[model samples]
Target: MSKLVEEFNDYRTRMNEVILSKNNLVMKRLWNLDTNTYEEGALDKKTKEMLGLVASMVLRCDDCIKYHLGKSYELGVTTEQMYEIFAVANIVGGTIVIPHTRRAAEYWEELQTNAQ
Candidate 1:
């Protein structure tokens, strides 16, 4: 498998473990609910991915942003959509998102370079 694919799988596995293990109480409380399902009604996959990308970016999780950006693109998210995601990120995550926004952009650019 390609290194990128392998790394993504590793991240997936670890994220799953963290969720299952209740690595953080907030994670368990907020995301691990039984009502949590992929049923986003009419929400398209790209929209959901865009939401995730914004969240990861605002949260300053490079690993998460990298994975979600790849997933978002695979789901047909355009660069324009990414810009929208950034806007929503700032709106939702607020001032603390400034630093994370910079870092996420750096990580995203790094990933693009590595892919070349």
Candidate 2:
């Protein structure tokens, strides 16, 4: 795995464990809701993930962007498709989203490299 990818996964996992271990009902329910929302519904996982990626980019949440990018890649979203998604996000989010797009592109490259 790429160092960036590894680091992100590690940090996310560690923090999630710490958070969940606290046994907070609200947090647990929120986590469950997020997981269930992305299941193979009528939208399909790939489409949902792509939508998630766009929303994350528009919202300027790096962690959410990376999570959605990883899920999109795992769901077999093509690079070409991702570019279209990026374009939509940039169009909707305007100039402020460009920086997030740059990071997203970098993360996508790392994912592709790791796949090979």
Candidate 3:
């Protein structure tokens, strides 16, 4: 795996471990809600993940961005689509999104490189 993917997986693994072992009472419910939110319904899972990516960027949540980006890739969201989403994030989030966008772009490039 690329460094970006490795980092994302490591972060997710650690967070899951912590939540499952130490914070299950409240964290498990929150995690479950999050899991449920990504299910296909009125909006497809891919669209929901794209929206989640937008929300993550606007909220300046790196972990959330990584998770959503990973899901978007898993769901076959294209790099072009990601550029559009980043554009939306840039418009909605302004200068605050610069760093997050940079990080996301780097991860996307890493994913592409590894795929090739």
Candidate 4:
């Protein structure tokens, strides 16, 4: 697995364990809902992942960016598609997204390289 994906899975596993152990019905339900929303839908999984990446960039959430970028790559989002996502992030987030966008771009390239 790509390092980012590995990290994300590790984090997800840990978080899921905590939520389940706590018996937090709301948290578990929210997680399930989030997962369902991201699955193939009217917008398609790839587009949703791309949009997730853009939102992650705008939110300056590295973990979110890593997760979404990995998903986007897994869904066969091309470098061109990634660049367009970055453009959207830039437009909506302005300069604040620069660092996040740069990190996401680097992670995206790394994922592509590992796949090759």
Query: Which candidate tops TM-score?
Result: 2
How many residue pairs collide in each prediction?
A: 0, 0, 0, 0
Candidates ranked by lDDT: 2, 3, 4, 1
lDDT of 4 by residue, 6-99 (tens): 7777988898798788978898899899899998878999889888888888889998888888788878888997899999999999999999
Error in Å for residue 12 of model 3? 1.7
Worst 10 residues of 3 by lDDT: 18-27
Candidate 1 per-residue lDDT, tens place, 18-63, comes to 7768668776666645224333558866677777788787777877
Best by lDDT: 2
The Cα local distance difference test for each model comes to: 0.69, 0.96, 0.91, 0.86
TM-score of each: 0.57, 0.99, 0.93, 0.88
**TM-score-sorted candidate list, best first:** 2, 3, 4, 1
Q: For residues 3-115, what per-residue lDDT tens digits would candidate 3 score against the true structure?
A: 77897899889878976988656788898898999999999999999999999999999988888888899899999999999999999999999999999998888877877
Candidate 2 regions with alpha-carbon error over 4 angstroms: none
What is residue 16's positional error in candidate 3, in angstroms? 1.1
Task: Return the clash pairs for model 1, or none.
Answer: none
Q: Candidate 3 lDDT (Cα, whole model)?
A: 0.91
> What alpha-carbon RMSD in Å does predicted model 1 have with respect to the real structure?
4.9
True lDDT of residue 90, candidate 3: 90
- Candidate 4: worst 10 consecutive residues by lDDT? 1-10
